[model samples]
Target: MICCLSSLSTCVANLELKVKKNIIFRSGSNDLFKPIAGFSILLLTAWSMQILSIRFSQLLFIFFVLFALWPVARKAWRKSLEGNIFSMETLMSFASLGALMINAVHEAAVVLWLFHIGESLEHYATQRARAGVSSLMAIMPETVMLLDDGILRAVPVSQLKPGDEIEIAPGGRLPADAILQDSMAAFDESALTGESLPVEYAKGQQIYAGSVIVDRVCRFIVTSEQGCNAIDRILKLIDEADAHKSPTERFIDVFSRTYTPIIALLSMMVMIIPPFFYDQPWDMWFYRGLAVMLIGCPCALVISVPAAITSGLAAAARRGILIKGGAALEKLAEIKVIAMDKTGTLTEGRPTVVCVITDKPDDEDRVLSLAAGVEEGSSHPLAQAIIRQARKRFNDYPIAGNRQALSGQGVKGDIDGRDVNVMAPTFAPPFAPDSILQGETERLQDAGLTVVVVALENVPLGIIALQDTLRVDAKKTIQALTAMNVDSLMLTGDNPRAAAAIAGQLGMKYQAGLLPRHKVEAVYLQQIAAPTAMVGDGINDAPALRAADIGIAMSGGTDVALETADVALTHDRLAGLPELLHLARRTRTIIGQNVTISIGLKIIFLLTSMLGVTGLWVAILADSGATVVVTFNALRLLRTEKTLPQMILKENS
Candidate 1:
């Protein structure tokens, strides 16, 4: 009796352990893990019982089939109660239940299991793509050091206001957009601009958020409000861009909505019509109708477009190109004419004093000194260039007083009690009409130099020739665009001679002396022929950028330009433009291929199933196989290098 009692105790212990394991599996936090684990357990139990007893095996099979079908059935029922009955869940539910009715329980279980697995895989891919953008937003620190009352105190970034002084540790990222103060250092701006080189900045220069201080401690005065930093703005743009759907995505959504119900109606007809016309058994046609229903599921077609678009967007973002959305990417592929700004788009935008000509030849230093003193306080690019040159030549100079800025002209001030003016050539003529100076001015203008004339008391002191050099890749970029059959044009407010000179070097057409309004009109004219893209990096280009079909902005561009643009190149280079266009075209091609594969497979399987040439397992293979193929094909966009070889070879040819 004691031995029997000990054996019973062992049996109770094993049962308790089994119950605990079952509870843990059912209560797990992962929604996907629970369904997958339960399905596997039920499938194994059902298959194992088949050798013991046929009756018992059938019961276990039915039990497991229901176990796998519960979630799909619940979802379909909910959708049906809401009067929206043509979802994927509804089709899958009907197919599986029909299979069960025909004693095809094993097939029913395997189909639902495969469908769930596909759903999980697609969800994971989408989440991974979205994580790439989310990682950008996570780079900012939650706390920052505030220099309050000359003392350092740690505070939340949201509490820091504009105009506050902040101290940054050597390796800390900048908390907000700021102006460098009291120090100079090299910064790693790669996170923001994707430029690998460390940029050197001195005191009084603007520093954007997300820049890391690499070498020394720095202090900066904040220039932007809390939550309004450059990174914040970029994140906002990314979010808005992701929310906008492409034309293909919208079409698929509509097609799926209309297609699902039609398939259901067809399946019903296949089940009911054959018995009336032929002498075939009822169960035979019923089974065929079930196979038809399984084959008609629109899983592959519904997921194909979005998967490719999301992958394309993520790939572009990794390469420092911000495509606003799938629609913008689609538009980019169709761009036939590229209207680009002269300064900051094709050229460096930083004009430097390349040549200095003096009437007396010995007074070059004096002419530059006077011009620099007058331009000392101005923030214009040309003014800064003059000041930089003056500091290099003469470290000490007399300060100018009573300074006044002339709109579109240059500046006027009192230097050594003499009225001095430094102006553009359009504002004033050469002080002395000497043939040598006139010839020099013409020569410089022909060479694409912006000649600034300096006059002392209405007499010309000399002319300072400044030039905004073409970007290193400007010619190559133009060639690539031409190879792609995209016509390139330069639109600028500068003189026709200078514009022509620059355009000639790049082999592009030019429309010179364009005001902001004129640039808008030019974009409209270009768009009349074909879709146009406007590339610019200044507030003046905002209107024109908005007018074009696609607007691309340089990363170092003004905030207004960035805000107005539909696409942004994170590095101030045109090399990314070709890659972006390539990606868009490849994405379009993949989407087309996916749609064709999905619809073609469905049509073939539908015909075969109706003719009784395909059975339940074959229908399942068609549905699952098409889904897998389309998904994997769409994922090819994640490796953009694979898409460039053919395009590169074509360009070389």
Candidate 2:
């Protein structure tokens, strides 16, 4: 549609140009080639846009090249295209061709040249914004391990079927939805779950695609096809939402549709108005109207907004932020509240023991040792911390006995022929420690630690302190948000104690013990005050993401959250939000500037066209020039802003 109509307009310009070239000899000796120049560009634009076979498109391209072969026509077109009114490529085309049709050759050429320059700038900006997501889609692995009859073999993932058992090695990516068949498996789900920790999988536990098996080799029974994996689902979300456009794009579309007709109508009035008021030649009025129409190309107004949005996307892509498109970037800029998850967002999601409480003689060390001994062969996070504590205390640790874990309590084992147990405080409190130790337990809990008691052979020894480690940049990020006058709130599924501890540390308001639905409700509540952005990594955070005004999912967040989110950061960085918002707001500003500049120039120039003070050449230049200026202005975003925070290191508070 765009191609066919554009060519028709080109014909109109050429008809006017031809009339002028013959009538006016003083404009230039080189003014004879206007029609060919306008004809070639319009023809190519039309042909390329028409839906056709590759062969036909190529054939049309051949004809375009034939224009180059006819050097004489090319020279005439080039000379005739150079009109004073040219803005961009369109300016040159309009000035030369429209002027020639209206008996003014120089103006049409300038418009044509200006249009091309704008197009070129807009294309560069679009490429940059599309870089990140395209790069991610490129990393999809093509092959996988196929298991059959207990024998493992390499095969294309597509060849595998459900019930096939694939042996996954440490550090290998999970290729399909499957259930773990191994005794123990540890998975790094950062890419899929956004949790910055390796999740331990037991037999019968479900595993998902895009999750890397970090340690302990395991076998999984494939239950789904390769394309139906979690990662694929996330990509599909971006595809489904592809129709979304930036605010700027919407405005430009509205303006482009109406601007040309309005200008054409006014130009006609310009011609008629002159003859009614004074004695003028019909040729003079007609030529002036043609000049007004020649300068009527809305190239700048049509392309300016998209150029700004594309430039913003491109700039975000360079910063390790994968904003899906111009629309997402624009939405992010309007975010006034950022509701962040306590675990994995503001804090490292990993839980660690940062404190210890001793109530009896060597209480802390003894309890840690017994807990570690019982958990020596376990894979749970708390167990691992105890084991590390044991190693740190003893330096060279003795071999532990066979161990077993009691679900939701603790692990158990034999230590030097003594049966030892390490369980929760409510399970085996005061087994070894005196009653005086009770105060220490309260102290640790009050200080924001989950206390797990370790008892050796039924004797309470000491208490273990476990807390989520926070991200180093969390405080600064919150501070930055505050400075921006945007509220920052921490929301979590964790217990009130843990949530309070984190919120206090960050100095932000907190909402604790929230289910996925509740998170959504909280966002809906915040929305009453202002636009909100919700960021999180867990599947539990998905509903809230969709409910928020703008949902930002960490680059490494769970597949569900990532797919549900409107904006995604590829670097897994929280700090990028501030910059992303900054960029989006600036993009809107640039678009507004482009629109104002384009329309302002036209209004002033349109008057000149009516008075015959500006020829068709200058009119074309003004029209196309606006497009190039806007494109250049939008691209300017790429050179600004540097450095975003890293996602890894430390644990959730």
Judging by TM-score against the true structure, name the best candidate: 1
Models 1 onward score TM values of 0.87, 0.68
Could you report the Cα RMSD, in angstroms, for every candidate shown? Answer: 5.2, 11.5
Instruction: Estimate every model's Cα lDDT from 0 to 1.
Output: 0.82, 0.67
- The collision pairs in model 1 are none
RMSD of 1: 5.2
Candidate 1 per-residue lDDT, tens place, 1-653, comes to: 35643553465445335434543223223543555555566667668767876676677677666756666777789888998789888998989999998898888878877776666556655655555656777898899999999899999988888899999988899989999996579998877655577888889978888889989888999998877876776667667777889998988989898999999999998998888787677888998898888889898898888888887787777667888988998788899999999998899888889988976878888989999999988999999999988888886987799999999888999987999999877776545544477778779988878898898897777899998888877887888877788899999998898898889999999999999999999999999999999999999999999999999999789989988999998667577777778888888999999999999999999999999999877887787788778877878877635434235534554
Clashes of 1: 0
lDDT of 2 at 301: 76
Show model 1 residue runs off by greater than 4 Å: 1-34, 81-83, 169-171, 179-208, 406-409, 425-435, 640-653
Which candidate has the top score in lDDT? 1
Deviation (Å) of 378 in candidate 1: 2.8
